[model samples]
Target: MQKQRKLVILGDSAFAEVAYECFTHDSDYEVVGFSVESAHLKRDELFGLPVVPFEDLEKHFQPGEVDFYAALVYSQLNRLRTRLYQEAKSRGYRAASYVSTRAFVWHNVQLGEHCFIFEDNTVQPFVRIGDNVVLWSGNHIGHHSTVEDHCFVASHAVISGFCTVGRSSFLGVNVALANNISIGADNWIGPGLTISADTEPGQLFKGESPAASKVSTKRFFRLKED
Candidate 1:
């Protein structure tokens, strides 16, 4: 059997724990430890492994001895993850990407470093997913689509063929983009929205909740009222 590569995860949030589980069980990487900023280092251990400070990470585990995965979410519009990913690279630690074994990625997809592609994702051919990107479970990246750097696409998103999602964008769950759509940088597209046209940079698309019906459930369903 091939030797497993050692890895260090940066962050202690729920996402980090999920990453640990995925990498430990699904991938060929062995998670040695976790790290966070000194200020946010609440615990000294996680999953029975050492949780060290990011500032002194090199001292604990040399960069050359292990790779890194910035297990962060779309905080700060993904800028935080991007910054830490770049910083880890600058510190001479190679960034690692995780693609779930259950995902279906086409042969020609171009996936970059520090990416986390969850289960049931369908990545079609000629797709380009940039660095520091996160594709949550059950997403569909249609053919010839490009999801730029530092973007976070939540579960069940549908980016149709020839679409382009710009850098640092946050696409919420169930967001669907029509074919040839161009989503601009720093955009925040909320859940259940369907975008058919191009959007400007930093645009925020929020879906409105449906209004409550004037008729009560008892009236609608003919149920007995108390």
Candidate 2:
């Protein structure tokens, strides 16, 4: 068997832990340590590995010897992750992308740097996903779809074929985009929304949350239980 590639993960947040678990189990990279900013450094160790400061990561782990993965969430509409990804690039460190082995990504699909595609994501043919994009589990990215940079697509979102999701867009859970639709930049698409037409830039579409029923569940069911 081939030797595993050593990796240094940036950040120690929940997303960092999740990224570590996935990379450890499903990918070709071995996570050696984690790195964070000095001000945000709370602990010295995570997952039984040393947590190095991002400012001095090269001192502990050489960039030439190890690859780096920025494990950050969609804070600031994914701008945080995108910023760190750029910092890594400026430091001459190559960004690592995670595409789960269980995801059905087409052979012709093109994915950019620092992308995180979780399990059960079905990416159809001719899909082009840009840098620092996060695709949570169970999403369907249909054929010829283009998801631009710094976008965060939540679980169960369905981006139909020939759709174009612009940069920095946040697609909530269960959101559905119809075929040939164009979602503009920095749009916030709320949960359970169906976008059949093109959206303007910086639009915020919020779906109404389900209201609670006046009657209790026990009274509504009316089933006798001894």
What lDDT does the true structure give each of the candidates? 0.88, 0.85
- Candidate 2: residue 91 Cα off by (Å): 0.4
Displacement of residue 205 (Cα, Å) in model 1 is: 1.0
Candidate 2 lDDT? 0.85
TM-score list, all predictions? 0.91, 0.89
Query: What lDDT score is found at residue 152 in candidate 2?
Result: 93
Candidate 1 segments whose C-alpha is farther than 4 A from its true place: 1-3, 209-226
Candidate 2: lDDT of 88? 76
* Residue 88's lDDT in candidate 1: 89
Model 2: per-residue Cα lDDT over 1-226, one tens digit each: 1337988999999989999999898898988999998989999999899998889988898867888888887676666777788887788788888999999999999999889999999999999999889999999999999999999999999999999999988899999998999998777787898888887766667647332234432233342321
Among residues 3 or more apart in sequence or in different chains, the pairs in candidate 2 whose N, CA or C atoms overlap within 3 Å are none
Candidate 2, 125: how far from true, in Å? 0.9
Off by over 4 Å in 2: 1-3, 209-226
